[model samples]
Target: MLGICVCLFAVFTHVLSQEAEEPVFYTCTEGYEYDRVREQCRDIDECALLDDACKGGMQCINHFGGYLCLPKSAVIYISKEGEQVPLPAVPAVPVVPAVPAVPPSQPQVPRSSGNQGVSLSSRTIRCAPGYTADEQNLCRDIDECATGRHTCGPEQTCYNTRGSYTCQCPPGYQKNGDHCVDRDECALTHYCMHRCVNTQGSYYCECNAGHKLASNNHSCVDVNECDVENPCQHHCYNLIGSFLCQCEQGYELAQDTVSCQDIDECSFSSYMCQYQCINSPGSYACECPEGYQLQGNRVCQDINECETGTHNCQDDEMCWNYYGGFRCYPRNPCEAPYAKTSENRCICRSQAECQGLPPSIVYKYMSIQADRTVPADIFQIQATNMYANTHNTFRIKAGNEAGEFFLRRSSNVSAMLVLTKPLSGPREYVIDLEMVTHHLTMNYRSSSLLRLTIIVGPYAF
Candidate 1:
C-alpha cells in the first residue's frame, strides 16, 4: 500500500513538473545564441536575466514570463556580476484599492438655486429678550408713554409718540434754573401798560381812559385831548394824563379849581387903575376911585383943588403931595443950590471929640466918653483938614450926652487903641470940643462931603 501510494505521488509530481517547466531558450531574432537550453528557458529578473537592467533604488519584479521595474521596496535579490552587492530586504507592501472616477455625465447643481437643505440661516438681530413690540419695531425709537419707560423730569410735561417722548413745559412755565418752572415776567422789573395783571404765560393791564400804553409797554402817558377838542372854557392846564382850566387876564379861577370867573376890579380900583388895585372874579375894568380922574398915564391922579383956592398956601410957601393929603412949607428954605457941586447940600460947624483936635465946621467919626472904662477902639474919630494955625490948642470930651464928654488925656504911639479893648455893637455917643483961643485967625475947610457928613454924624444939642 505504501509503494502504490509512493508511485501515484511520483506520477502526480511528474505531471506537475512537465506542465510548469519550459526549456531555457534565448529567443533573439538575430546574432546571440545560448548554449544552455535549460538555463535560458527559465525566467530571469532583468536585474538577473539581462544583467542589472534597473539602476540603483530600483528593483526587478518577476511576472509570468517577464519582469517589472519597481521601486527598491520590491527587490528580493542582488547581483554578483554587478558586485557581491548587499541585498536590501524587500518589505511587504499592502495593496491599495483603486479609486473609481466619477462620471462627467452626472448632473451638477446650479449656483443660482436658493440654498435649501443643510443651509444655515443668516444670524438674526433681536431686541433684548425682555423687550417686546411695545418697545420697538425694527429697533426704532420707542414711545415711553406707551412702552412703560416714561419717567419725566421734575416739573416737566412728557408727550409720548410711537417710539419716543418729548419733555415740554405747560403754559406759564419757562425753562429756568435748568428746569421747567413757573415763570414770573415781573421778576426782572414790573413791566406794564398800567396796572400789571400776571397770568399764565402772559400778562394783562388796566389803564385809565386818559392814558395809553407806551411802546415799551410799561408806561401810561397822557392822551392829547386838546388835539381832539377844547374842553376848557379859558386856559387849559395839562396834568400827567388830564386837563384843567384857568382864567386869563381880568378873569379869575372859580371856586372849582379848574373853572373860571370874571373879576370885578371896581372893588379895589379897576384892574387897569395905576393908583388902586382890586381882586375880583374872572374879568376886571379900568375906573377911577373918589377924588381922582383918568390922566395921560392910566393912573387916577388927584386934581389940585387948591390951584383955584379950594385950599390955599402962603405966597412964599408951596403945596406938595403928602400921600392923598396936602402940606405946605417955606419954599425959600428948600431952594436948589446955585452951583452944581453943592446940589442938595448944607453946611454947618460941629464940635470935636478928642484932645489935640480942634472944633470946626468939619466931619468926624467918634467922640470920647469915659476913660479906659468905656474902651478905646470905639473912640476913633477923624479930625478933618487939620494942622491949621500954629499955637492953636484943642480939647475933646466923651460922655453919654453932649453936656460933658471925656478928654483924650494921652496918645499911644504904638497902637490906635489898647489891645485890651475891642469894639462893641452900635451905640450912642456925644462929642464936645473947643479950639484954643489964638490971635491969628486961620481958615480951614474940609471937603464939602465932610461938611455935609458932619451934619449926618453925631450932634451935640
Candidate 2:
C-alpha cells in the first residue's frame, strides 16, 4: 500500500508540471492595441479615432489607449466691450491604460490548451498634459505648429514644448491681451542720432541740414559743404555745419561772400609812393618819373647817368651829373681874357688884359642833394704855388649878395667855402672865391680867384 501511494504522488507531480509549461497569451493595455500586421502592441490614437474626445473649446491629444482635453487658448483676451474674457481651465491628465511590460524581442504567444488560451490583464495610468504616447509607448510632444488644431491667431506664432504649446506675437509686434499690435520702437529707445521717424513696427532716422545719414542708419555724419560745391571764389573753409569764403592777400571779400574784390591800397595814403601810385587788380605799384627808378616799394631814387655811362657826352666834353639829368661842358671852360693853362685853371696872358682882374683863376664844380643842412663846409681852396713871407686872406667876392656862402681861412694858404643857409633845387649857383696874398716884407700884393659852380639835385636819394 505504501509503494502504490508514492507512485500516485509522482504521477500527479508530472501532470502539474506539464500543465504549468503551457504558453500564456497577453492582451494590450487600455490605451494600447495589438497590431495584426506588425504583430506588436501599439498605442491607440484616441484623439484621431474619436471626434467627440474633447469639448468646451478644448484641444484633444492622444495617448496610449487614452485621450486628453486641454484649453484651446493659452492666454486671455478682452471683449469688444472692454470686458476681460478668461480662457478655459486646463483639464486634468487623462487616464491612460498601462502598457504591458513585455519584452519586445520575445512577446508572449498564445498556446493551444484544449481550444482555449490563458491571458494576462492590464491596468490604466495617467500622463502629464501636452504629452502623448508614441508607438513605442513613450510620451512625446505634439507639434501644434504643424497641425491646424492650434488656436493661435493669424498674427501669432505657435511653438511646441515637451508637454505643451505656446502662442506669441510675431517679430515687430507685441501681444496685447489675445491680439497682436505693432510695437513703437522709436518711442521705446533712443535709436537715432538725429530725428527719429516711426513707421509700422519700425523706425528710421533723418539728418538735419549739412548732415548725412551714416551707414548704420541710426547715426548722422557731417557733410562737407566745401567739397560738394565751393561757393568761395578764392578759398573755401569747411566748418562743422557751414562753409566760409576767404579772399587772397591783396583782395577783399565781397558782400555776396562768393566773389573776391580788389583792394585799392593806393587810395589809403598819399605817401604810398614817392613819385606816383598805380592801382592794380589785387595790389598797388609805385612808379617813378623818367630818368628815375624805384628804390624800394615807395621811394624814388634818381639815376646817375654820368656814373652809369648812359650819357651821350662827347670825349672832348666833361659830363656833370645832376638829379635825373646830366650836362656836357667843354673840357676847358675859361673864355675871352682868361686863357686855359690846365684842365681847371686859367691865367691872364696879357697883364693889360688882366688889369683889375686876378692873375689866375681855378674852376671847380660840385653837386649836392636838395635840402642840405646849413653851415656845411662844401669846398676847400688851397694855393697851388706858395711864396715865402706871404699872408693870405680869403673871401667870397661874388655870389655873396644872397649871403648864402662864406669863406674862412684855416691856414696861411688854405680856405673853406661854407654854406650858411639850407637850399633846395634844381638850381645852380656860381661863386667867386678870392684869395688876396700880401708880401709881409715886400711891397707886393696879388689876387687869385676860384670860380665854383654848385648844382643841386631834385631828391635826397
Q: What's the TM-score of each model vs. the native?
A: 0.29, 0.54
The TM-score, computed over Cα atoms with residue i paired to residue i, of candidate 2 is: 0.54
Clashes of each: 23, 2
Give the per-residue lDDT digits (tens) of candidate 1, residues 208-262. 8778876656568887765555666776767667777767887777776556667
Assess the local accuracy of residue 57 in candidate 2 as a C-alpha lDDT between 0 and 100: 38
Query: What tens digits encode model 2's per-residue C-alpha lDDT throughout 1-461?
Result: 01111011100000011133332223443445444345545665756655555433357755334555555544433242445554334333333323333333344333434323222222111234554546544334567778666888987877554345567676456778888887776776566787888776556789988888888787788888888988789999998777889999889999898799999999898888888899999989999977788987988888889899999999989999877677787898888798998889999989898889898889898887778888899899998879999988988889778898888889999998888888887788989999999998997899999999998876654
Query: 115 in model 1: Cα distance from truth in Å?
Result: 26
lDDT of each: 0.40, 0.69
- Return the lDDT, model 1, position 460: 10
**After superposition, candidate 1 runs with Cα above 4 Å error:** 1-137, 145-157, 161-163, 174-181, 188-195, 205-210, 214-221, 228-231, 237-246, 254-256, 267-281, 286-461
Which candidate number would show the highest TM-score if scored against the true structure? 2
Give the worst 10-residue stretch by lDDT in candidate 2.
Answer: 6-15
Question: Which parts of model 2 are misplaced by more than 4 Å?
Answer: 1-189, 194-209, 215-218, 244-246, 252-258, 265-274, 295-301, 307-316, 386-388
